[model samples]
Target: MKSPINLEVVHKVIDVFRAQYKNRDLAAKTEKILFNLAATGHRVSEQNFRAIVGHIRNHDMMSPWFIVSNVNTGYWITKDEKELSAYLDQELNRMSNQFDNVSNLHKRLRHGKTKGTGNQASLF
Candidate 1:
Protein backbone atom coordinates (compact mmCIF):
# COMPACT_ATOMS: atom_id res chain seq x y z
CA MET A 1 0.00 0.00 0.00
CA LYS A 2 1.12 3.53 -0.73
CA SER A 3 1.77 6.00 2.05
CA PRO A 4 -1.09 8.40 2.80
CA ILE A 5 1.32 11.26 3.26
CA ASN A 6 3.76 12.44 0.59
CA LEU A 7 6.04 15.38 1.27
CA GLU A 8 5.27 16.75 -2.14
CA VAL A 9 1.59 16.49 -1.47
CA VAL A 10 1.97 17.98 2.01
CA HIS A 11 3.88 20.88 0.54
CA LYS A 12 1.02 21.55 -1.84
CA VAL A 13 -1.50 21.40 0.97
CA ILE A 14 0.60 23.84 2.99
CA ASP A 15 0.67 26.22 0.06
CA VAL A 16 -3.09 26.07 -0.18
CA PHE A 17 -3.33 26.71 3.54
CA ARG A 18 -1.12 29.80 3.37
CA ALA A 19 -2.91 31.18 0.34
CA GLN A 20 -6.29 30.61 1.89
CA TYR A 21 -5.67 31.36 5.57
CA LYS A 22 -2.69 33.75 5.63
CA ASN A 23 -2.34 33.36 9.37
CA ARG A 24 -0.22 31.21 11.69
CA ASP A 25 -3.15 30.05 13.83
CA LEU A 26 -4.92 28.61 10.80
CA ALA A 27 -3.42 25.14 11.11
CA ALA A 28 -6.49 23.39 12.45
CA LYS A 29 -8.80 25.26 10.11
CA THR A 30 -6.52 24.55 7.17
CA GLU A 31 -6.36 20.91 8.13
CA LYS A 32 -10.13 20.70 8.07
CA ILE A 33 -10.35 22.39 4.69
CA LEU A 34 -7.61 20.24 3.18
CA PHE A 35 -9.11 17.10 4.63
CA ASN A 36 -12.38 17.94 2.96
CA LEU A 37 -10.63 18.62 -0.31
CA ALA A 38 -8.68 15.38 -0.09
CA ALA A 39 -11.77 13.38 0.86
CA THR A 40 -13.30 14.42 -2.43
CA GLY A 41 -10.68 12.21 -4.16
CA HIS A 42 -8.91 15.04 -5.93
CA ARG A 43 -5.17 14.91 -6.52
CA VAL A 44 -2.90 17.92 -6.08
CA SER A 45 0.40 18.51 -7.90
CA GLU A 46 3.84 18.21 -6.31
CA GLN A 47 5.18 21.56 -7.37
CA ASN A 48 2.11 23.28 -5.97
CA PHE A 49 2.46 21.28 -2.81
CA ARG A 50 6.10 22.28 -2.48
CA ALA A 51 5.19 25.92 -2.92
CA ILE A 52 2.58 25.63 -0.17
CA VAL A 53 4.92 23.91 2.28
CA GLY A 54 7.59 26.48 1.53
CA HIS A 55 5.19 29.31 2.29
CA ILE A 56 4.08 27.83 5.62
CA ARG A 57 7.60 26.86 6.71
CA ASN A 58 8.80 30.30 5.73
CA HIS A 59 6.18 31.80 8.04
CA ASP A 60 7.31 29.47 10.88
CA MET A 61 4.19 27.37 11.04
CA MET A 62 4.46 23.94 12.64
CA SER A 63 4.43 21.65 9.63
CA PRO A 64 3.95 17.94 10.22
CA TRP A 65 5.40 17.22 6.75
CA PHE A 66 9.05 17.66 7.67
CA ILE A 67 8.77 14.67 9.95
CA VAL A 68 8.11 12.49 6.89
CA SER A 69 10.13 13.87 3.97
CA ASN A 70 13.68 14.96 3.26
CA VAL A 71 14.35 18.71 3.26
CA ASN A 72 15.44 18.75 -0.38
CA THR A 73 13.25 16.60 -2.61
CA GLY A 74 10.13 16.74 -0.42
CA TYR A 75 10.08 12.97 -0.82
CA TRP A 76 9.72 10.26 1.77
CA ILE A 77 12.97 9.24 3.44
CA THR A 78 11.77 6.01 4.97
CA LYS A 79 11.29 2.83 2.95
CA ASP A 80 9.18 1.10 5.58
CA GLU A 81 5.49 1.87 5.88
CA LYS A 82 5.57 1.15 9.60
CA GLU A 83 8.21 3.84 10.02
CA LEU A 84 5.99 6.34 8.24
CA SER A 85 3.07 5.39 10.48
CA ALA A 86 5.28 5.80 13.51
CA TYR A 87 6.38 9.24 12.32
CA LEU A 88 2.75 10.32 11.96
CA ASP A 89 1.96 8.91 15.37
CA GLN A 90 4.77 10.96 16.87
CA GLU A 91 3.58 14.12 15.14
CA LEU A 92 0.04 13.58 16.40
CA ASN A 93 1.36 13.09 19.90
CA ARG A 94 3.24 16.36 19.67
CA MET A 95 0.16 18.16 18.39
CA SER A 96 -1.88 16.72 21.24
CA ASN A 97 0.61 18.09 23.74
CA GLN A 98 0.41 21.52 22.20
CA PHE A 99 -3.36 21.38 22.17
CA ASP A 100 -3.47 20.39 25.81
CA ASN A 101 -1.19 23.26 26.74
CA VAL A 102 -3.30 25.80 24.87
CA SER A 103 -6.53 24.36 26.23
CA ASN A 104 -5.24 24.61 29.79
CA LEU A 105 -4.17 28.19 29.28
CA HIS A 106 -7.56 29.12 27.90
CA LYS A 107 -9.30 27.36 30.74
CA ARG A 108 -7.21 29.19 33.31
CA LEU A 109 -7.84 32.56 31.71
CA ARG A 110 -11.56 31.89 31.49
CA HIS A 111 -11.84 30.87 35.11
CA GLY A 112 -9.33 33.30 36.54
CA LYS A 113 -10.17 34.67 40.03
CA THR A 114 -10.87 38.35 40.38
CA LYS A 115 -9.75 40.71 43.19
CA GLY A 116 -12.94 40.46 45.25
CA THR A 117 -13.39 36.96 46.54
CA GLY A 118 -16.03 35.43 48.94
CA ASN A 119 -19.53 35.99 47.50
CA GLN A 120 -18.18 36.99 44.04
CA ALA A 121 -16.08 33.84 43.88
CA SER A 122 -19.09 31.82 44.81
CA LEU A 123 -21.11 33.54 42.09
CA PHE A 124 -18.42 32.76 39.52
Candidate 2:
Protein backbone atom coordinates (compact mmCIF):
# COMPACT_ATOMS: atom_id res chain seq x y z
CA MET A 1 0.00 0.00 0.00
CA LYS A 2 1.18 3.51 -0.76
CA SER A 3 2.01 5.59 2.27
CA PRO A 4 -0.07 8.65 3.05
CA ILE A 5 1.35 12.10 2.44
CA ASN A 6 2.74 13.60 5.62
CA LEU A 7 0.24 16.02 7.19
CA GLU A 8 3.12 17.93 8.77
CA VAL A 9 4.67 18.55 5.38
CA VAL A 10 1.33 19.66 3.91
CA HIS A 11 0.83 22.22 6.69
CA LYS A 12 4.39 23.40 6.31
CA VAL A 13 3.88 23.96 2.59
CA ILE A 14 0.59 25.80 3.26
CA ASP A 15 2.42 28.08 5.70
CA VAL A 16 5.12 28.77 3.12
CA PHE A 17 2.49 29.42 0.43
CA ARG A 18 0.65 31.85 2.70
CA ALA A 19 3.90 33.67 3.44
CA GLN A 20 4.37 34.35 -0.27
CA TYR A 21 1.28 36.57 -0.17
CA LYS A 22 3.05 38.76 2.42
CA ASN A 23 6.52 38.61 0.84
CA ARG A 24 6.24 39.29 -2.85
CA ASP A 25 9.98 38.64 -3.13
CA LEU A 26 9.50 35.05 -2.12
CA ALA A 27 8.71 32.90 -5.18
CA ALA A 28 6.16 30.11 -4.77
CA LYS A 29 7.75 27.82 -7.30
CA THR A 30 8.15 24.11 -6.65
CA GLU A 31 11.91 24.36 -6.20
CA LYS A 32 11.57 27.30 -3.84
CA ILE A 33 8.99 25.52 -1.71
CA LEU A 34 11.11 22.38 -1.58
CA PHE A 35 14.13 24.41 -0.56
CA ASN A 36 12.18 26.14 2.18
CA LEU A 37 11.02 22.81 3.58
CA ALA A 38 14.50 21.34 3.41
CA ALA A 39 15.87 24.25 5.41
CA THR A 40 13.60 23.24 8.27
CA GLY A 41 14.68 19.56 8.00
CA HIS A 42 11.39 18.54 6.39
CA ARG A 43 12.38 16.33 3.50
CA VAL A 44 9.46 15.91 1.12
CA SER A 45 9.61 14.41 -2.35
CA GLU A 46 8.76 16.68 -5.26
CA GLN A 47 5.91 14.37 -6.27
CA ASN A 48 4.44 14.53 -2.80
CA PHE A 49 4.77 18.28 -2.68
CA ARG A 50 3.03 18.68 -6.04
CA ALA A 51 0.25 16.32 -4.98
CA ILE A 52 -0.33 18.33 -1.82
CA VAL A 53 -0.42 21.58 -3.72
CA GLY A 54 -2.88 20.11 -6.23
CA HIS A 55 -5.20 19.04 -3.43
CA ILE A 56 -5.07 22.46 -1.81
CA ARG A 57 -5.82 24.12 -5.12
CA ASN A 58 -8.62 21.67 -5.96
CA HIS A 59 -10.53 22.07 -2.71
CA ASP A 60 -10.17 25.84 -2.84
CA MET A 61 -9.11 25.92 0.76
CA MET A 62 -9.02 29.13 2.82
CA SER A 63 -11.78 30.94 0.90
CA PRO A 64 -10.80 34.09 -0.95
CA TRP A 65 -7.30 32.62 -1.01
CA PHE A 66 -6.67 31.51 -4.57
CA ILE A 67 -3.68 29.56 -5.75
CA VAL A 68 -3.27 30.27 -9.43
CA SER A 69 -0.64 28.84 -11.74
CA ASN A 70 0.37 29.95 -15.20
CA VAL A 71 3.07 28.92 -17.63
CA ASN A 72 4.83 32.27 -17.37
CA THR A 73 4.29 33.02 -13.68
CA GLY A 74 4.25 29.49 -12.22
CA TYR A 75 2.26 29.23 -8.99
CA TRP A 76 1.00 32.14 -6.92
CA ILE A 77 -1.47 32.75 -4.10
CA THR A 78 -3.93 35.60 -4.31
CA LYS A 79 -6.67 36.94 -2.06
CA ASP A 80 -8.20 39.27 -4.64
CA GLU A 81 -11.27 37.73 -6.24
CA LYS A 82 -10.75 39.83 -9.33
CA GLU A 83 -7.27 38.43 -9.81
CA LEU A 84 -8.54 34.89 -9.41
CA SER A 85 -11.38 35.43 -11.87
CA ALA A 86 -9.00 36.90 -14.42
CA TYR A 87 -6.68 33.94 -14.04
CA LEU A 88 -9.60 31.58 -14.60
CA ASP A 89 -10.57 33.44 -17.75
CA GLN A 90 -7.03 33.32 -19.05
CA GLU A 91 -6.79 29.59 -18.45
CA LEU A 92 -10.10 28.95 -20.17
CA ASN A 93 -8.98 30.95 -23.20
CA ARG A 94 -5.70 29.12 -23.34
CA MET A 95 -7.34 25.71 -23.16
CA SER A 96 -9.88 26.65 -25.81
CA ASN A 97 -7.12 27.75 -28.17
CA GLN A 98 -5.22 24.55 -27.53
CA PHE A 99 -8.34 22.47 -28.26
CA ASP A 100 -8.81 24.24 -31.60
CA ASN A 101 -5.22 23.68 -32.55
CA VAL A 102 -5.48 19.98 -31.70
CA SER A 103 -8.69 19.60 -33.69
CA ASN A 104 -7.04 21.22 -36.70
CA LEU A 105 -4.07 18.90 -36.39
CA HIS A 106 -6.35 15.87 -36.32
CA LYS A 107 -8.17 17.09 -39.43
CA ARG A 108 -4.89 17.58 -41.25
CA LEU A 109 -3.73 14.09 -40.26
CA ARG A 110 -6.96 12.55 -41.50
CA HIS A 111 -6.71 14.45 -44.79
CA GLY A 112 -3.18 13.19 -45.28
CA LYS A 113 -4.15 9.63 -44.45
CA THR A 114 -6.99 9.73 -47.00
CA LYS A 115 -4.52 10.93 -49.64
CA GLY A 116 -2.09 8.08 -48.82
CA THR A 117 0.57 10.76 -48.18
CA GLY A 118 1.31 9.76 -44.59
CA ASN A 119 5.11 9.63 -44.31
CA GLN A 120 5.23 6.44 -42.26
CA ALA A 121 2.66 4.42 -44.20
CA SER A 122 5.14 1.70 -45.15
CA LEU A 123 6.53 1.34 -41.60
CA PHE A 124 3.34 -0.43 -40.57
Candidate 3:
Protein backbone atom coordinates (compact mmCIF):
# COMPACT_ATOMS: atom_id res chain seq x y z
CA MET A 1 0.00 0.00 0.00
CA LYS A 2 1.15 3.55 -0.76
CA SER A 3 2.17 5.61 2.25
CA PRO A 4 -0.28 8.31 3.26
CA ILE A 5 0.84 11.81 2.37
CA ASN A 6 1.64 14.38 5.02
CA LEU A 7 -1.01 17.10 4.71
CA GLU A 8 0.24 19.74 7.11
CA VAL A 9 4.00 19.31 6.85
CA VAL A 10 5.00 22.52 8.57
CA HIS A 11 2.93 21.85 11.65
CA LYS A 12 4.14 18.28 11.76
CA VAL A 13 7.77 19.34 11.42
CA ILE A 14 7.34 21.88 14.20
CA ASP A 15 5.85 19.27 16.52
CA VAL A 16 8.65 16.87 15.68
CA PHE A 17 11.28 19.51 16.37
CA ARG A 18 9.58 20.38 19.63
CA ALA A 19 9.87 16.77 20.71
CA GLN A 20 13.31 16.14 19.21
CA TYR A 21 14.88 19.27 20.62
CA LYS A 22 13.24 19.12 24.02
CA ASN A 23 16.53 19.33 25.92
CA ARG A 24 18.89 20.99 23.48
CA ASP A 25 18.97 24.77 23.37
CA LEU A 26 19.56 25.54 19.74
CA ALA A 27 18.00 27.65 16.99
CA ALA A 28 17.99 26.18 13.50
CA LYS A 29 18.28 28.06 10.26
CA THR A 30 15.50 27.79 7.69
CA GLU A 31 17.69 25.66 5.42
CA LYS A 32 18.77 23.46 8.33
CA ILE A 33 15.19 23.01 9.43
CA LEU A 34 14.11 22.12 5.93
CA PHE A 35 16.94 19.65 5.68
CA ASN A 36 16.06 18.02 8.99
CA LEU A 37 12.44 17.79 7.96
CA ALA A 38 13.49 16.20 4.71
CA ALA A 39 15.62 13.68 6.54
CA THR A 40 12.42 12.54 8.17
CA GLY A 41 10.91 12.00 4.69
CA HIS A 42 8.76 15.14 4.62
CA ARG A 43 9.02 17.37 1.57
CA VAL A 44 7.95 21.02 2.08
CA SER A 45 7.77 23.67 -0.60
CA GLU A 46 9.31 27.10 -0.21
CA GLN A 47 5.93 28.77 -0.56
CA ASN A 48 4.41 26.58 2.15
CA PHE A 49 7.41 27.16 4.41
CA ARG A 50 7.26 30.89 3.97
CA ALA A 51 3.50 30.94 4.48
CA ILE A 52 3.75 28.89 7.68
CA VAL A 53 6.51 31.12 8.98
CA GLY A 54 4.43 34.19 8.35
CA HIS A 55 1.43 32.51 9.95
CA ILE A 56 3.39 31.62 13.08
CA ARG A 57 4.50 35.21 13.38
CA ASN A 58 0.99 36.46 12.75
CA HIS A 59 -2.20 35.32 14.54
CA ASP A 60 -0.07 34.55 17.61
CA MET A 61 0.66 31.07 16.30
CA MET A 62 -2.87 29.66 16.03
CA SER A 63 -4.25 31.55 19.05
CA PRO A 64 -2.51 30.53 22.30
CA TRP A 65 0.29 28.81 20.38
CA PHE A 66 3.69 30.55 20.17
CA ILE A 67 6.85 30.35 18.09
CA VAL A 68 9.99 32.13 19.07
CA SER A 69 12.10 33.61 16.31
CA ASN A 70 15.86 34.01 16.57
CA VAL A 71 16.20 37.49 15.16
CA ASN A 72 19.92 37.35 14.61
CA THR A 73 19.96 33.96 12.94
CA GLY A 74 16.55 34.20 11.26
CA TYR A 75 15.58 30.87 12.69
CA TRP A 76 12.09 29.89 13.79
CA ILE A 77 11.87 28.31 17.20
CA THR A 78 9.46 27.50 19.98
CA LYS A 79 9.80 25.88 23.36
CA ASP A 80 6.28 24.74 24.03
CA GLU A 81 2.60 24.83 23.12
CA LYS A 82 1.78 26.28 26.58
CA GLU A 83 -1.61 24.63 27.06
CA LEU A 84 -3.31 26.93 24.54
CA SER A 85 -6.71 25.30 24.78
CA ALA A 86 -6.93 25.96 28.52
CA TYR A 87 -5.86 29.56 28.03
CA LEU A 88 -8.47 30.03 25.30
CA ASP A 89 -11.14 28.39 27.45
CA GLN A 90 -10.50 30.84 30.28
CA GLU A 91 -10.57 33.79 27.88
CA LEU A 92 -13.79 32.55 26.29
CA ASN A 93 -15.47 32.24 29.68
CA ARG A 94 -14.30 35.68 30.71
CA MET A 95 -15.61 37.22 27.48
CA SER A 96 -18.92 35.42 27.88
CA ASN A 97 -19.29 36.71 31.42
CA GLN A 98 -18.46 40.24 30.29
CA PHE A 99 -21.11 40.06 27.59
CA ASP A 100 -23.66 38.75 30.05
CA ASN A 101 -22.88 41.55 32.49
CA VAL A 102 -23.27 44.14 29.75
CA SER A 103 -26.55 42.61 28.65
CA ASN A 104 -27.89 42.69 32.21
CA LEU A 105 -26.80 46.28 32.66
CA HIS A 106 -28.49 47.24 29.41
CA LYS A 107 -31.69 45.54 30.50
CA ARG A 108 -31.61 47.38 33.82
CA LEU A 109 -31.05 50.72 32.12
CA ARG A 110 -33.87 50.11 29.66
CA HIS A 111 -36.30 48.81 32.29
CA GLY A 112 -37.89 52.24 32.60
CA LYS A 113 -38.55 52.44 28.83
CA THR A 114 -41.74 51.27 27.17
CA LYS A 115 -42.39 47.54 27.16
CA GLY A 116 -42.83 47.70 23.37
CA THR A 117 -39.32 49.14 22.92
CA GLY A 118 -37.81 45.87 21.81
CA ASN A 119 -35.94 47.41 18.85
CA GLN A 120 -33.26 50.08 18.41
CA ALA A 121 -34.02 53.55 19.75
CA SER A 122 -35.08 55.77 16.80
CA LEU A 123 -33.69 59.27 16.35
CA PHE A 124 -36.49 60.39 14.05
Candidate 4:
Protein backbone atom coordinates (compact mmCIF):
# COMPACT_ATOMS: atom_id res chain seq x y z
CA MET A 1 0.00 0.00 0.00
CA LYS A 2 1.09 3.57 -0.64
CA SER A 3 2.32 5.52 2.39
CA PRO A 4 -0.06 8.05 3.95
CA ILE A 5 0.62 11.61 2.81
CA ASN A 6 2.81 13.78 5.04
CA LEU A 7 0.98 15.98 7.56
CA GLU A 8 2.74 19.10 6.27
CA VAL A 9 1.31 18.51 2.78
CA VAL A 10 -2.19 17.87 4.18
CA HIS A 11 -1.98 21.12 6.14
CA LYS A 12 -0.88 23.07 3.04
CA VAL A 13 -3.81 21.79 0.97
CA ILE A 14 -6.22 22.59 3.79
CA ASP A 15 -4.73 26.09 3.92
CA VAL A 16 -5.26 26.64 0.17
CA PHE A 17 -8.86 25.38 0.31
CA ARG A 18 -9.56 27.55 3.32
CA ALA A 19 -8.12 30.55 1.45
CA GLN A 20 -10.11 29.82 -1.71
CA TYR A 21 -13.40 29.08 0.01
CA LYS A 22 -13.00 31.53 2.91
CA ASN A 23 -14.46 28.83 5.12
CA ARG A 24 -13.99 29.76 8.77
CA ASP A 25 -14.35 26.20 9.99
CA LEU A 26 -11.70 24.89 7.63
CA ALA A 27 -9.47 27.88 8.29
CA ALA A 28 -9.81 27.31 12.01
CA LYS A 29 -8.61 23.74 11.68
CA THR A 30 -5.73 24.76 9.46
CA GLU A 31 -4.75 27.59 11.77
CA LYS A 32 -4.79 25.36 14.82
CA ILE A 33 -2.48 22.80 13.22
CA LEU A 34 -0.20 25.35 11.56
CA PHE A 35 0.03 27.46 14.70
CA ASN A 36 0.99 24.43 16.76
CA LEU A 37 3.75 23.63 14.24
CA ALA A 38 4.90 27.29 14.28
CA ALA A 39 4.93 27.27 18.06
CA THR A 40 7.63 24.62 17.75
CA GLY A 41 9.39 26.83 15.15
CA HIS A 42 9.30 24.16 12.42
CA ARG A 43 8.69 25.41 8.87
CA VAL A 44 7.24 23.28 6.05
CA SER A 45 8.30 24.07 2.44
CA GLU A 46 5.73 25.72 0.13
CA GLN A 47 6.23 23.31 -2.80
CA ASN A 48 5.80 20.26 -0.62
CA PHE A 49 2.78 21.91 0.96
CA ARG A 50 1.19 22.67 -2.42
CA ALA A 51 1.70 19.12 -3.72
CA ILE A 52 0.10 17.62 -0.63
CA VAL A 53 -2.87 19.98 -0.77
CA GLY A 54 -3.33 19.24 -4.46
CA HIS A 55 -3.49 15.52 -3.75
CA ILE A 56 -5.99 16.04 -0.92
CA ARG A 57 -8.33 18.23 -3.01
CA ASN A 58 -8.13 15.83 -5.92
CA HIS A 59 -9.16 12.96 -3.65
CA ASP A 60 -11.77 14.92 -1.71
CA MET A 61 -13.86 16.16 -4.65
CA MET A 62 -14.64 12.76 -6.09
CA SER A 63 -18.37 12.12 -6.72
CA PRO A 64 -20.05 9.28 -4.87
CA TRP A 65 -21.43 6.21 -6.56
CA PHE A 66 -25.21 6.43 -6.53
CA ILE A 67 -28.49 5.17 -7.90
CA VAL A 68 -31.56 7.33 -8.00
CA SER A 69 -34.53 6.56 -5.76
CA ASN A 70 -38.17 7.62 -5.70
CA VAL A 71 -40.77 8.34 -3.02
CA ASN A 72 -44.33 7.03 -3.14
CA THR A 73 -47.11 7.47 -0.51
CA GLY A 74 -44.66 9.09 1.90
CA TYR A 75 -42.33 6.17 1.55
CA TRP A 76 -38.85 5.96 0.05
CA ILE A 77 -38.58 3.23 -2.59
CA THR A 78 -35.61 1.44 -4.12
CA LYS A 79 -34.67 2.24 -7.67
CA ASP A 80 -36.40 0.39 -10.51
CA GLU A 81 -34.89 -2.92 -11.57
CA LYS A 82 -33.79 -1.51 -14.92
CA GLU A 83 -32.09 1.48 -13.34
CA LEU A 84 -30.50 -0.66 -10.64
CA SER A 85 -29.18 -3.14 -13.22
CA ALA A 86 -27.76 -0.37 -15.37
CA TYR A 87 -26.07 1.20 -12.39
CA LEU A 88 -24.68 -2.15 -11.33
CA ASP A 89 -23.32 -2.77 -14.83
CA GLN A 90 -21.61 0.60 -14.93
CA GLU A 91 -20.13 0.21 -11.45
CA LEU A 92 -18.94 -3.32 -12.24
CA ASN A 93 -17.25 -2.11 -15.40
CA ARG A 94 -15.56 0.69 -13.49
CA MET A 95 -14.36 -1.55 -10.63
CA SER A 96 -13.38 -4.62 -12.63
CA ASN A 97 -9.62 -5.39 -12.48
CA GLN A 98 -9.55 -8.81 -14.15
CA PHE A 99 -8.56 -7.48 -17.56
CA ASP A 100 -6.05 -4.94 -16.28
CA ASN A 101 -3.81 -7.42 -14.40
CA VAL A 102 -4.27 -10.13 -17.00
CA SER A 103 -3.10 -7.92 -19.87
CA ASN A 104 -0.12 -6.64 -17.88
CA LEU A 105 0.99 -10.18 -17.03
CA HIS A 106 0.55 -11.25 -20.68
CA LYS A 107 2.67 -8.33 -21.89
CA ARG A 108 5.40 -9.02 -19.36
CA LEU A 109 5.56 -12.70 -20.28
CA ARG A 110 5.63 -11.89 -23.99
CA HIS A 111 8.49 -9.43 -23.58
CA GLY A 112 10.52 -11.59 -21.20
CA LYS A 113 13.55 -13.24 -22.83
CA THR A 114 14.06 -15.94 -20.17
CA LYS A 115 14.19 -19.47 -21.60
CA GLY A 116 12.95 -22.67 -20.02
CA THR A 117 15.40 -24.53 -17.81
CA GLY A 118 17.04 -27.53 -19.47
CA ASN A 119 17.27 -29.66 -16.33
CA GLN A 120 14.33 -31.87 -15.18
CA ALA A 121 14.90 -30.68 -11.60
CA SER A 122 14.40 -27.10 -12.76
CA LEU A 123 11.03 -28.05 -14.30
CA PHE A 124 9.93 -29.61 -11.02
Give the number of the best model, judged by TM-score.
Answer: 2
- Answer with 2 or 3, whichever has the higher TM-score: 2
Off by over 4 Å in 2: 1-4, 23-25, 101-124
| Model 1 per-residue lDDT tens digits across residues 1-124 | 5334455656555455445443323333333554544764546454444455555455545433332442222333232457567656866888888776676555565565664543323322
Model 3 ranges with Cα > 4 A deviation:
1-7, 21-24, 59-65, 79-124
- List TM-score per model, in order: 0.31, 0.64, 0.43, 0.25
**Candidate 4: tens digits of C-alpha lDDT, residues 1-124:** 5455676645543443334333222223334444444555645454444355446535653123111212221111122466546545765765566555465555555455444423222221
Cα lDDT tens digits, model 2, 26-86, are 4466777688788878888888887887778777764567667666556777776777788
- Judging by lDDT against the true structure, name the best candidate: 2
Q: Considering lDDT, where higher is better, how would the candidates rank from best to worst?
A: 2, 3, 1, 4
Evaluate model 1: give its lDDT.
Answer: 0.48
TM-score of 1: 0.31
Per-residue CA lDDT of model 3 for 1-124, tens digit only, reads 5333344775776575565533225656567777777788876765666666666556454333344444354343443545334444665788888776677666777777875575542310
TM-score for predicted model 2 compared with the true structure: 0.64
Worst 10 residues of 3 by lDDT: 62-71
